[model samples]
Each structure stands twice: as structure tokens, then as C-alpha cells.
Target: MRTQSHLRIGDQPWVKWSLITLALTLVFLLLLVPLIAIFVQAFSGGVSSYWQNLTDRYTLHAIGLTLFVAALTVPINLVFGVFLAWLVTRFEFPGRKLLITLIDIPFAVSPVVAGLLYLLLYGANGWIGSRLMDQDVQLMFAWPGILMVTVFVTCPFVARELIPLMQQQGREEEEAGVTLGASGWQLFRRVTLPNIQWALLYGVVLTNARAVGEFGAVSVVSGNIRGETNTLPLHVELLYQDYNTVGAFTSASLLAGIALLTLFVKSFVEWRQARQRAALSEDEA
Candidate 1:
């Protein structure tokens, strides 16, 4: 009996078109519509109104606070992630697997729960907070607490990106560098950094996106104090609560703009990574 060769599922034209149509419909309804609506409503009162809302003192403060959090969050996580990734991928020790598992705690735990955990540990009545408070230091209900939760939530991104790539690349190149008398810093800067830079940048982009847009944990820890502890996301909520539709959407549009910028950067990094892979393939060939 004869059989068809090169057969594949969903090869029919009708099935292909149906899938495409369904995906586009979902995209339009779920993503595009909301994104468009944000801009539409933001400028509904005209450009001057939108600009006024954006330049409002509270709005400006929120924007500044959000950027401050992201700026701090990215670098701290970047260093920590690189260190953790290197330790796990390059060494064998007790609790190595457990350490790797613990890296995922941020992802596994709910953001709100994570915020509460911080609050419990660092609130005025709590063990650590009671001592810190004696010295007139406060963490919870302030910027420090916001930064802590943001860092906790975004910590996994860079390491997650690097770990698999590092494992696959292995220590051969690094070992060779060491044998040739390269120092640890030199070896990482020259050998490992070049190979994993794209993944590192991709991870940074994701971390920044999450850090900038973080709301739930930040809201809980920040005390939602307008023009002070409030970040952009919290400010948007405040605007909406105050029945300032234009202001709310204006703040939201800035966030949406940030998300778009992140998507663009992520796509660029992926494209660059793809090109690098192709070049390496050609060299091998």
C-alpha cells in the first residue's frame, strides 16, 4: 500500500486561514483595541489637556518615582542574576539545585503576597522593622519598600534568560581562557559576556518592563501616597478614582508607550540574536 510523504497537520488552506483569522481577531479585541482606546481617551480632551495632565505635579512625580525604581531595580538585578547564573552553570555544590529552584520563588509567589511578606518582615510592629524603627528607619509604606518588592518580583528575569544559554555554551571556552592565564574578570568580560550579551540585554528589557509597570506589590507597599510614594501605575489608579478620565488615560498612555518601547527593544534583541546565530551556523558550516 502507498502512503503520502511530507504530510503535516493543519496544512489545509481553510484550516490555516481559520487559525490566522482567529489569532488576528483575538489580537484586535484583546490587545489592539485597548491600546488604541488608551491613546484615544488620553487625547479626547485635546493635546493641551493631555499635556496638562502629563505635566501635572503629581503625574510628574509619579513618572519620576517609577523611573527611579526601574533604574535601581535593573542594575541590582543584572549583577545578581549574572552572579547566580554563573554560579549555577559553572559550579557544582551542595544545594545547587535548591538554589536554582529558589530563584523562581519570585515568579511562583503572587506579587501581592510578596508585598505582604515584605510588610510583615519590615513593618513597624515586625521584628526587623521594630529594630530599624528604633534607629528612625522605615522601609514599608515608602520608596524603599517599593524598591524591595520591585526587585524581588523582577529578580528572576536575567538569570532565567542566561542559565540555559550558559549551560549549553558550557565552560570549555572559559576553561581555555583560564588556562591561558586570563583572570576571572577578563575571562567573563571577553569570553562569556560576548556570547551571552544578547540574552542579557533581552533579560534587562523584560526586567525593566516589569519593574516599570509593577502595580500590585508596589501599591501595597507604597501606601499609595499621591505625589510622594506613588509610582505611575498607582497614580493612574488615583486619577481614575478621582474621576479624572483624561488624566488616568494620559498616565496609562505613558505606560502603554513604555510597553511598546519594550516590545520594540525585545524584538530588536531577538533579531540581533537570530542574526548572530545564523553567522555562527555559517562559520560552522
Candidate 2:
């Protein structure tokens, strides 16, 4: 029995260390190595070349457009996400499940398919496109189209994050606030928003990351017009096609930097959430 117990204890550490080592190796190979390679390639031609690559007229414009699209996409989705979460979780309604499934359609569809769908709907010869074209409106190959696709792709992030949380929280506190004569907006602001703010922020972070990193859908609509419609991802492809390897990697590095920053923010949010849950558990105990 003593020998068996000792063997079991020894086996436990071996298994634990083996798993830990495997996880670290995968992380280093899949994430850290690629990240390090990007920076190394970006700086291969020296700091001046790296700076010039980033500051090139087309590259700068691509970066600016990427930021612009993310700015518009994140806020619109945030508003829509909050309202959708509130509606679905706070009230019982017909077609609520259908509405949720529709919200998730973007996730189910490929980004390329999403771009194609928009093109068919808003292309020059498309259904509404013909009517809009009479007014000289260009939607398919313009910034508006890019913004639309980004919003479409990212709309579900915040809602997904909040729905489960709001459901678990229930409407009891909201009911209490309402009974106290709090207005609908006041109840949301004073009670609901406070409870869900962290989750909302987490969702927004995710939405922003997807919006900025989005390539396929944006690529199809953007028409790849350099210095105008090209986003950072598209610009990276353009540079590579033009045989500017260092430039391509430099552009890619900027994107990787944004991703790293998002990951950091996500980690922070998760840490805060864990702390909040611990506190709540202690209070209940």
C-alpha cells in the first residue's frame, strides 16, 4: 500500500509536468515564434527601412483606414450588442430564439461568403444597388461597404458575451429597481450596466480585434485600392505581391502588435472577472 501510494504520487507530477511542457512548447511554436519572426523580418533591413515602410503613403493610409473602420465598427456593434442582449435576456418575446440564431449567422458563414453576399445585395447590378446607383451611391467597392462587412462580422461578439451573463443574473434586481420607481434607462444605467460593464468591455475588445484584423470580407469589398480602400491586411498582401518582403512583414508586424495588445487587455479582463467571481463567492459563503 505504501509503495502503491508512492507510485501514484510520482505518476501525478510526471503527468502534470508533461502536460505543462507540452502546452508551453505549443505556445512557443505557434504563437511566440511567429511573433518574434515578424519583428525580426520587419527590422531586417534596419530601423530606417522599417520606418519608411510603415510611413509610406499607401501603408500609412492603410493603417488609418483600418483604424477608422475599427472605430466605426466597434461602437456600432457595442450599441447593437447591448440592446440585443437586453432584449433577449430581459424580456420574453416571440421569435427570441430565432433572433439569436440570426445574430449568429455571420459566425456560421465564411468571411468570403459574407463579402459575396454583400456584393450580391449591393453590387451595381444588385437588387437595391441599381436603385441606389440612380442616386450615384457606391456601396460595393467603397469605405461604406468595408464598414458594413466589419459590422456584420463583429456584431455578435458583445451580445454573445453578455447574454449568458445577463441570463444568469436574472431580472430580479432589475425588477426591484423598477419597483423603486427607477426609469427604464435609469435602471439600466444604475444597475444593469454596472453588472455587465466588464463583460461588455471584454466583448468590445474582441470586436475591435476582429474588426482590425479582418481581411477576407474587407478584401472582397475594398477593391484593394491602395491609399484609399486597402486595410492593413490587404496592404500586407499588396506589398508581398509587389515583392517588397520587408515592407510586407513590417505592415504585418503592426497588425501583430495590435493583436498582442488585445491579448493583454483580454488577459487583464479575465483576471478581473476571476477576482469578481471570487469576491461574490466569498460573500455568498
Candidate 3:
């Protein structure tokens, strides 16, 4: 008996190799080259100069303020993301779709627009500015404004991550827990938390990255006060504007390192998620 031969679609070797070469070239030029350039320029002035630039008082302050903003923003967004995901996924209500759409508005809106909106609302001539001024509360061009815009821009990260995962999980386990007389807090702590923890963490990592790296919106609201409102990105811009190329690149190296570290963590999370899914499949099999 003669066996039928298999035919492969898109089996042109030349086409495959050409596409691979193109992709590699683009990645090298667009990503790897810029990354290496940052380090090369940063150390062009030698270790001492690089160290001095990094340890300058203003640079230290900028780093500290960036960390502070990330610390404050991540937790708030994490809680809000989880709560919003749970609310929308586990309940049916009027305007539920609209609420979810609104939550996503930030993602659709430009970061610059997000900052400008806050400025319009809180600037001295803005609607509530006079009221806040009467109370001696500072918003625009202050830490509060920076914090507010950071929160607004990063709001969608966790919620976007959790919403689909929670929806796919459905309410079966939760319902079972409730039927077993578990309190709301008990159900969440025991039944729900474990299921969503990985996704929650993934979201937190993303939120932290964006919070620290955010430039556009924060720049608009921060007033770019050196050693004060100057986040790391803003600090880099200030350094570059002052013709301190080495200083700017040095400051930028820190952010690049952060981006690299975040990429590493994200890869690990994705690997673990894949492993978890494979293990579940094996058990079912």
C-alpha cells in the first residue's frame, strides 16, 4: 500500500529566512542598540564620573521621589483593580458595561490629556482651585497633582489584567464557599485570593513600572521642580536640556535597568502561568 505524502503550507525556505532576518535586524536596531548606547554613553566619563552623576543630591532626590510615587500608586491601584474586577465580573447590574468602559477611558486617553484634565480642574483659575486655595490645599504643580495623575493614568493596568481572568474563573468556587457558610471576607481570603494572586501580582508589577516610568502626564502636573517634583524621567530631561549628556544618560540608565528588571519579572510570571495551566491540563487528563 502507498502512503499519502503530507504537504506543508508556506514552506518556502527563502521566505522564512528572509522574514527571520528582517525581524532580527529590526529588534537589534530598535531595541538592543539603544539599550547598549545608554550604557556606553553613561560610562563614557569613567566609573567615578558615572558614580558622581548618579549620586548627585538632585539625582538622589529624584530617585527617592520616583520610588515614593511608585510605592503610593501601586498599592492604591492594586486594591482598586481587584475591587473593580470583582465587582464587574461577579455581579449583574444596570450600567455595568458603561462602568467598565469608563474604567478603560484612561487607557484610551492620552497621558498628556489626563494631566491637562487635572490641570483644568485644579489650576489656580480652575473650577475647584479657588475652593482648594481657600483651604490652603495645593493640588496643581504639587505632589498631590502628581499623585492624582499617576493614579489616573495607571488605573487601568491591574483592572485590565484581572477582569478577563476573573470572568473566565466564574463564580462557581465562590458560590460553593458561600454555601458552606463562609463569610464574605473568609470566602475572599480562602477561596478567591489564591486563584487571582498571580494575576494580581502581574498587574502590580506593570503598575509599578508605569508609575516609575511615567513622564508625559507627570511632567505636565509636576512643574518639574528639581529635587522636588522631578521624577527620574523628568530629571533625565532636565539633565539633557542642560547639555549634561553623561548625566542624562546616567540617570536614564537607572530607568533602563528598571525596564530590564521588569521585563525579567514579567517573563517569569508568564512562564509560571504557563506551567500552572499545563499542570492543570495534565491533572484533568
Clashes of each: 0, 0, 0
The lDDT values for all models are 0.95, 0.93, 0.91
Q: Please give the distance, in angstroms, between residue 200's alpha carbon in candidate 1 and its true position after superposition.
A: 0.5
Q: Rank candidates, lDDT, best first.
A: 1, 2, 3
Q: Write the per-residue lDDT of candidate 1 for residues 175-277, one digit (tens) a residue.
A: 9999999998999999999999999999999999999999989988898888889999999999999999999999999999999999999999999988877
Return the lDDT, model 3, position 143: 80
Point out where model 3 deviates above 4 Å. 1-9, 281-285
> Which prediction has the highest lDDT against the true structure?
1
lDDT of 3 at 273: 72
**Model 1 misplacement above 4 A:** 1-9, 281-285
* Pairs of residues at least 3 apart in sequence or in different chains that clash in candidate 1: none
User: Against the hidden reference, what TM-scores do the models get?
Assistant: 0.95, 0.94, 0.95
Question: Cα deviation of 24 in candidate 1 (Å)?
Answer: 0.9
* Candidate 2 Cα errors over 4 Å, as ranges: 1-19
Give the per-residue lDDT digits (tens) of candidate 2, residues 1-285.
456556654377778899889999999999899999999999999999999998999999999999999999999999999999999998889999999889898899999999998998899889998899999999988899999999999999999999988997889989999999999889989999988988999999999999999998998899988888999999999999999999999999999999999999999998887787687678768
